[model samples]
Target: MSDPGFRTGPDGVRWRDLNHNGVMDPFEDPRLPDAVRVDDLLGRLGLDEKIGLLFHTVIETGPGGSVLDGPGAISKTGTRHVVVDKRVNHFNVHQLGPAHEAARWHNTVQRLAQETPHGIPVTISTDPRHGFSENAGASFSAGSFSQWPEPLGIAALRDEQVCREYAEAVRSEYVAVGIRAALHPTLDLATEPRWARQLHTFGQDPQVVTELGLAFLEGLQRGRLGPGSVACTAKHFPGGGPQADGEDAHFPYGREQVYGGGHFADHLAPFRPAVEAGVAAMMPYYGMPVGLQLDGEAVPEVGFGFNKRIVTGLLRDELGYDGVVLTDWELVNDNHVGDQVLPARAWGVEHLDAAGRMELLLEAGCDQFGGEECVEVLAGLVADGRVSEQRLDISVRRLLMVKMQLGLFDDPFVDEALADERVGTPATVEAGLAAQAASVTVLADEGGLLPLSGSGRAVYVEGLSAQDAAALGRVVERPEEADLAVIRLAAPHEPRSDLFLEAWFHQGSLEFPPGLPVRLRRIREHCPVVVDVTLDRPAVLGPVMEAVDAVVGSYGSGGPALVRALRGEARGRLPFDLPRSMEQVRTHHPDQPGLGDPLLPCGHGIPLGARV
Candidate 1:
């Protein structure tokens, strides 16, 4: 029955009467039907079920060959605690819709879960999910998850609609399968150039990040796919960049967060926008700062996820953000071989066991644990009466409340086939192309050296394969292939030595591959050169730019916008400033300057034809 107080007029969904109280409630969901399964479920559960939802666990299940492994593993387990047995819930295990084996395996788990007593369908998620790649162990998925040009690749477009389109494309793909949550839209302000994860951010501009991030969150959740409306998590709060020595905080030893730069508030700014936009969740960074707060009392905080002052106090108390707070994966131990990973100490109870840790996380204000074994530990604690049933009930309720708010019960189903309709659809592909085009920056084209009228006797290219040079209407083994040596560059990642991409951070620093300048110089010596920096960032180019007739930052393989820039179809502007030299990056805000060098300032898009 519609509530008499609710007014559902043509205000559209965003502005609709969500509270059913005859008026609009912008971000709040319509008053729900209690969805109080947690209270009753908690009452009925012997200490066992009470602790189940406390932790998001990763069991000893292998990649198990796509989502198909779930069923086979579940049947083999032969344990009641294996609730929906073979449908064991784990992220990145499956959901590759195109792979015949992956799809079959995903469906098998779903079928088995239906037969389960409680039918708790496995909650599946992906880093990105549906795309050309299904990379289980890397920075970006290879086989699935639409790989829209990494956020930095698109930040220069400065078009929120374009960002919204990309988000919608991701949403469409995610909703097809059962990925009701996206651990993405990383809004962490990457205030440092040396940081490895910097490319994942939108850019140096907070306004751009906030607006783009909010659009993405709204688009992902707006569709509200059944069982859950793919929740968007804006991540690594209090900023993740500026890691001391560019190390990650995923390990215990790397957990100390330093705030030497006076821009912690800048990092915090993007998150407030996320909260205002009504995103489904947030991920606290693994880092904790050793800095003293305003009071002069030593406030070296714990990891943001487990810090009561940050989670419950700042996030919940001051800003009033109430959503699921998932910790970054494996927040407890370090996963590296020969790096600094040590036991953590700070902020919370001095001596803590597994149960004690879970207790502290909850008390400090986080709602769920991710990539950890808190579930089994919490269950064991309850069985031993160390954690009370009442305490467990509070957490379970909060988790279930989110599920209900996402309309999961009414829409609990995943289409093993709807994936094709979303993955890199025309709109998605176009967005990718557009981002590629917008990313290029023409640092300097003195005397209008660009818009090279196809008058070169022979156009040569460098670093470009002979095949690619031909695509640009020429040939090239080296720069001597033709008169115009267009070096279409690609930033290489640390090759997957062990099949999975580990230590996944590149310096994003710009130093030409040894003697690339010599090659460009030799080409410059022969003909007017067109050097296309096919990288997203502007490298230390004092030598290269001087030698070349023209230099264009194609921004990673000439994104669609970048390609357009070269063809003189679009104005290639630098969205962020590039340092004129390396020393500039070193002296002025070396630790966390979002823009490394100012060779080309933000918004300096050069229009080759407007040569007035």
Candidate 2:
């Protein structure tokens, strides 16, 4: 049954003839149901093609958004090697160029895919890109996309509507550059303050996280998952928070996840909303459970990706989720970039070989492997009859169904001209700036010292550019020469430089350096000082808060947003608690929320103009 709405040969505009049979196959027809189309495509796939569909690996675009014909900085293989040779269609892109160029590059990749035997279009995914952080493994700084505050900032506003609007902006920008998937809206509750990955999470409250996460998911996906929607892969499922001592599971030292307070149920609460919303995919974290028990049965102490009891028994059977389960990056094989080698985060399964790890993950019911391009290994498993062809078919069907639902088979190419116009428009930029300013939380304001009367008062600034400070008042050389001083500090973390990837993560102690508070106190003596701290991770700001006259918390705001907050043009509230001391932080449970003697509670915030 060929649909007249589509063409097969040179005139194929509305729909692509994926199979290249010179006729519109059932899978190519947009008029048919997605499940029927998926079945038709699944029946035609060879063993290698089916196996290729199950691996979602990293791929880098060349400088100026050109397709990499050879090895890239991150990607070991070239574009042709992954697409044509390996037949892998799913990719997670990082460090993209301008929107138009990225769209052109995407079209080029699709053209390559069209030449393949099955002509399956590539599904491009990306980490959170519309924020301030530029960590290679976590998120990219918003280049061409509309920039907003981090997810923590959005959580600080505590507005569902704002969450929805922020996600809508993300979707529009991503779709413009031909990206089909979002690897975020990190539902993990920031229960552990020292955890390095808290910048992207929605904070500690289950209710707020669930509400905001659902709204964000709804906005990204719209009503139903279709051509216009960007499929969201709500991640680090069953909670990635509660890292043993606030250390990330990305490194070997922080591989254990301990539920010390037995607040495991609280950690799992937010994911129920994501599952209920029918999210396109779920990514399990790398942390292996140390002493996790569910329903009176002890869960296997392996990484969630390789734990059948967690992935299949808990996520599939208990929660009734059948969506594509993608493992977090580098779970199976070690990653080597230059002289640095990051061991595979196999956790409890570290003793297993590559093939052994793959088989276990497949048994655990994960549909795809993230950050891996070893197609030959999986093909060998099937060929040896170790992993059955039937098991491979189950995952292939799920993968194909998603592509069909995304309307990739119908039309995969993006309009480069439309992309340039839609991305980072003036209005979107304004909206993002507003959100950033609105999320600034005022923790302290002694004697109503805020809403700085911009009466050309000489201002001494630290951690802020002199140019940006000029807008507030006269930028002075020293604190003694200024009428008032404004200081900006990032939430402190003990720096680690052992591994290349570990250096990128801000892990370790939340306490400020001993000399920092003393230095701040000296500046306060010269003039009334207002301090702004970027709370990427909740820091133990007892001394700094005491030394400064006014203290404000910023998630990921720039100089303009900080100025707006200080000028009483915007308001914000705390999304998570601030501990009085590092000892208080240590006494608290990793999985519990608001347990310690907080200096300022979760809902604490002062309006700039409000009297103290």
Candidate 3:
């Protein structure tokens, strides 16, 4: 069939002849059904091309958003080598510039893809970028887009509409600059209070996570896949919480995800809603499920990425999710960037070589390998008859289907002018600010210290700037000279200096150092203190709870939003239980919900008038 998208060559050959058979293939036809297009494209792809589709690695852009030539922090391979020589089309972009520049770079990259034999349009994906935190491996800070609270903050608001609106706003900014996939809306239940990555998740409740995940997917995808949509990869599937001893899976020590409560089903509950909502893709976590029993059988104690019982047997067969399944980054080969050498997160399959790991993941039903560019290894597997070419077609079809559904085949280039105008619009900015204000959870309000009068009152502040204090009222040098002390403290973590990216995880003991508590006590004694602490994860708040006259739990609010929160202009309830002490955290099950005595429970928030 002659497809509409194909152009006739000068010698009567079809320009969109993907198979190079001098004819317009069904995949080249825009008018055909997606199934036909995907099947046609999949059948025509060589082993090398198919292998390329399986590797979705990171790429870094230059300062002006041009593709980098050499190695960088996030990626070991160069842009041209991966896209052109290596034949990988899908990329997870890191550290982009202004919208227009990003648009230009995207177009430039698209031109590279267009030069290929198949000319498949590149699919650019990104992690959460419209939030405050700038953790390089996790999420980017809101640079060109409107800044909002983290997912935890949105959960704290406890408003489905706000979650939907936030997703929509994020979609607008992402699509503006050619970002086709959102590597987030982390559906992992934050049951383990001390898990470092909990900031990205909604909370402990499966219902709340499900609702928020649905809302987020609906907003980002606009209820369907098309040009305007940012395909949501609802992540850390089968749930990534329940880390034994509250450790993260990103490191060797935190490699085991133990379900001690025998509530594996509880962790899997949130994913059902995501599947029902039709998420575009799923990302399995790195941790191996240690001694997790499902359906009266023990699941293979392997990382979810390479576990057939989980990805294929459960997520694919039982729940019936046919979408693309991408593994978490660097699961095959060890990554050596600069002085740091991050071992491959193969988990139980650590004994396997790179080729063995790739073959195992393929058999385990992972369609794509995130943060890996070793397409040659997969091709070698096929050549050696360890992995089948027929098996490659299955994943390639899924990948092509997504590309077609995203409207990438029709037109992948973005308009730079529109990108510049659309990103960080006034409406989105206002929406972000509003959400930020609403995420401020007031934990304590002793003696009516909150809703502190803003006019003509001398303010002593820490963490918050003196200039910001001046905006509220008067700024005083010392707490003794002020009516009240306005302070800000991040949720404390026992700092880790080992390994390159270990410090960024923020795992380990969630307690304040002894000196911090003593200093806070002294400051509180000097004057009545109104403290706002950013809760990236649940913290042991025993000392802060005791020393401050009032404590406000912040997810990711700005100076203005913090001021609003202090002045009673903002509102939010706690998303997770704030444990009273480290001892309480120790006694609680990592997988179970609502255990131990909470200082302030989830859904605890003070009303504006109640404090005054």
Candidate 4:
């Protein structure tokens, strides 16, 4: 095998000789302008290589941090096939064990890319991972990363400084692990109280969401896209809330995002700040707009990824955002994992074939397709003279520009040893722990029963382990034998185990199971019950609130943090309103404020010293 080469320029900066021509290409020269570099690189790529840049699919790594040879959970194409044979340069990685392990896997992926002709360093991206939730389809737990509160928890504090601190910590962890793109800072407004994904958003108010969103973007991007930054993708573009009856967009039944409250522009207000903050990417949601009137014209009831009017007209032309626009995952091809098959979220364009869907996405101004690997479908379109190479270049340029802006071409490798030092460092973990403590909103406390002032009382625990409960006071097995009972409960969701990915989504009615009310009543009968419900969604806590002496809303908080919150060492405020009943949730406009006299309104929280 020949030695595939390097060249030194006049300025003494050695270029990779990416084209292997023994001459320095414009794209290989770090000194060249990004536009010239992108153009030069684009010119050297053939049709297959250009199509490869558009697909960003899921990639799984082995226990040793090497690309797996067998099929992964999402993609049928193996790592080698995707990187070498298929020429894919973008991957959304999932399920790596530790920080150092993920870093090693990332370097391995990059090394595989280095073997390609163009030697384009692969961009690794992930959904929100530095959080408490472990939803497989949505987010990962803080495995080796510093864990912070959910996005809603950050909003509850209502402090941009905290958001900045959190983002900086997340940025450091992400960069250390070789994740150059953060697929989050989900700017979707929590106006829709029952939306499953609201845990990922800053809460209801457009103003507050806008402020925190900007701060988060500034922190992640480090005020610009460069070597030290993880490019933030502020998403579910133009806002994904206002779903009819709080149904999410991930399923067929929840495919419509409506604006019945005439607040289309309000939903989009947060993105304005994100764009102003120079977020590197925008991700359109999977839902199609249903009879949404914007700027005196009705938006077509097509999915945002296929809606040219929304993507090109609204985001591009109206808002003046030219950053890379990536569609939410799996809109082009149906995902078949083992025996179960989930249909593509082609939503309004469901009638279209894969080629038609790709054409619509391109026409809608999407630069890349998320969770999709159908490069052959696109290549066929170009071959048939239906789609032009000129169209392909438009997205390819944006994609390459993002890579250059992130300094991926200059240096994509990370120090594997540094990953251990930087990820979940003492300082980062401390900050996260503090945030967790701060975000535990004390929603309802009857007769000031909180701040569990005096310890050594007999305490009965549920949900939390006995050892963890012992820290507060004497732990008891039975509620009847205790002076006080502390019960922990996650917010209720109707379980859907039909589809493979549906279980990951915590959707459906917020009402608790029929047996839960009976159990809680029995517990409270013995002693004053202190209930802490983890508020992933706005849980319908009417029965629990009615029975318990105190109710606390926890968003991604830990056992120690919960104990601290109970002991009055920290403060929290409600990020969004909690409705009184499921009836109100069904009837209320998804975009409006205050859901028919909420049990606890937004910004309602009791500090340790404050009177309840």
Best by lDDT: 2
Candidate 3, residues 423-529, lDDT tens digits: the string is 99999898888788778988877787778665688778888877667767788898878878888888888788767678788877778887876887887777788
Select the stronger candidate by TM-score from 1 and 4: 4
Ranked by lDDT, top first: 2, 4, 3, 1
Estimate, for each residue in 1-612, the C-alpha lDDT of model 1 and write its tens digit. 111122334643322222234544322223335354434433544444444455554322234323223333212232223434322333434334353334444445444444443333345555654322223321444344445556665565667787787777777666665556677777865555444565667776777778877887888877432343677777877566656544456433345656666666777788997787777677787777667363355554666767777787788888888777776665443233233332432223335655676667777777676655335666666678766777666766766566555554333445546545545566666666655555556667785766655533456654555553443465644444566666665443233223112344454345556576777677777667776664434456667777777777654333334435566644445545666654665554423445543666666677554642
lDDT (Cα, tens digit) per residue for candidate 4, span 1-612: 223245677889966766667677788888888889999999988888899999998889887777888688766778988998889998888887787888888888887887787988899999999888877567888888999989989998899999999999988888998999999989888877778899998988888889999988888898768889898888999789888878888889999987777777788899988877788999999999898876778888899989999899988998888889998999998888889888999999899999999988998899999988888898899999988999989889888988998888877878988889999999999899889888888888877888887677999988888777777899988988999999899899888877887887888898988788788888888999899998888988888888788999988988887887788855778888888888888888887755758888888988874632
Rank ordering of all candidates by TM-score, starting from the highest: 2, 4, 3, 1
lDDT of 3 at 219: 93
TM-score of 4: 0.96
RMSD of 2: 2.6
TM-score of each: 0.80, 0.97, 0.96, 0.96
Between the candidate structures 2 and 4, which one is better when assessed by TM-score?
Answer: 2
lDDT per prediction? Answer: 0.56, 0.88, 0.85, 0.86
Tens-place lDDT per residue, model 2, 327-410, is 999888999988788899999999999999999999999999999999989988988889998999898988888888888888
Q: What residue runs in model 4 are displaced by over 4 Å at the alpha carbon?
A: 1-14, 609-612
Clashes of 2: 0
* TM-score quality measure for candidate 1: 0.80
